[model samples]
Target: MSPQTHINFTANPPKLHYKPHINLTTNPPQPLYKPTSTSVQTYINLTTNPPQCHYKPTSTSLQTHINFITNPHQPYYKPTSMSLQTNINLTTNPHQPYYKPTSTSPQTHINLTTNPSQPYYKPTSTSLQTHLNLTTNPH
Candidate 1:
């Protein structure tokens, strides 16, 4: 094999990636297992509002307590009282999207993933050929 990406790409998806516009660097990382944000969101257009994947890592003073009530109907668990307390780490970094998303609207191109192993790819109005191509190379 040529060790080159053998796909003949036109001007749409751009030549440098399997996907598009993913800024690997200058992006902050998220915590390992942070709780999902409880913010209100609709099925907003990604061009306006990008999907939230990473959580704010600066959760220095979070003490969450969860209480579970005993249910007689469910046989899976029989607990009198169960409470969970979680103390997330104090290290914090502001949340970052998958890639540098368009602060401006009409995002003509978008990257579908941040998975490092996959060949970089993006969906663009210009590049219909490489739109949403998720491949698994089980090396």
Candidate 2:
């Protein structure tokens, strides 16, 4: 019982179960092996089905219209000359009408468009007393 154990019990070698070599040769750059749509047992072989990949988003370059004033989480401010100036002086007797000190100029003027309904008084040329008490009667 020993001629190398009868040639290792009559030698039998041939078993490679995994046949897949498709080359229907019309040679246009073929070596494709694809199994990854985040692969988890995806072998799809209904005659190698692979022809569907689509992406389309466009209504003037991918549908986008955002102007929260150039949105930096929306809240941008710097606009004050009495909120972009809209002069309103509906003059009658909004507390004594006017004082014209455009000459004999002695100014300490901070009448940022004065409002008690347009009462801008900036005259200090050594007390040149100009007084107008328009006695309120504009009904």
Candidate 3:
């Protein structure tokens, strides 16, 4: 007779037999405790604009502000509020011969200086004559 061997095996893994109990009655799991008051306050503040902190003005910032106020050609310089008086002078003083003429005179000046030999000579001459007449008789 031939010899025979026998072996035994379990159908499921050991972990499946030891599953933890879950309480379906309760809502989703949450932290055991609340966050601190300061953390909560910081979260609230983050939702809005934070307060500006006080600090000494640096020399660079002061210089920039000064330059912005002083230099008329600077991009950040606000000429509207500061130079309104100058603009008024230009507009008002067009009637005065001592103050040159209106803003349009600059175009005539450019035409005379840059286009003296170009086809614009005739139109520029007519414009210059009109400007002279207007200046001589400001009414």
TM-score of 2: 0.11
**Residue-by-residue lDDT tens digits, candidate 2, 28-73:** 2223312111111101111101221231111111111101111121
Give the local distance difference test score of model 2. 0.18
Candidate 1 vs candidate 2: the lDDT winner is 1
Judging by lDDT against the true structure, name the best candidate: 1
Q: Candidates ranked by lDDT, best first? A: 1, 2, 3
lDDT, model 1: 0.21
Roughly what TM-score does model 1 have, to 2 decimal places? 0.16
Runs off by more than 4 Å, candidate 3: 1-72, 80-133, 137-139
Query: TM-score rank, highest first?
Result: 1, 3, 2
lDDT at residue 59 of model 2 (Cα atoms):
10
- lDDT per residue (tens digit) for residues 1-139 in model 1: 1111112222322334322111111112222322221221111111212334452222111111221111121222211211111211122112323333322212212222323443332211221121111112223
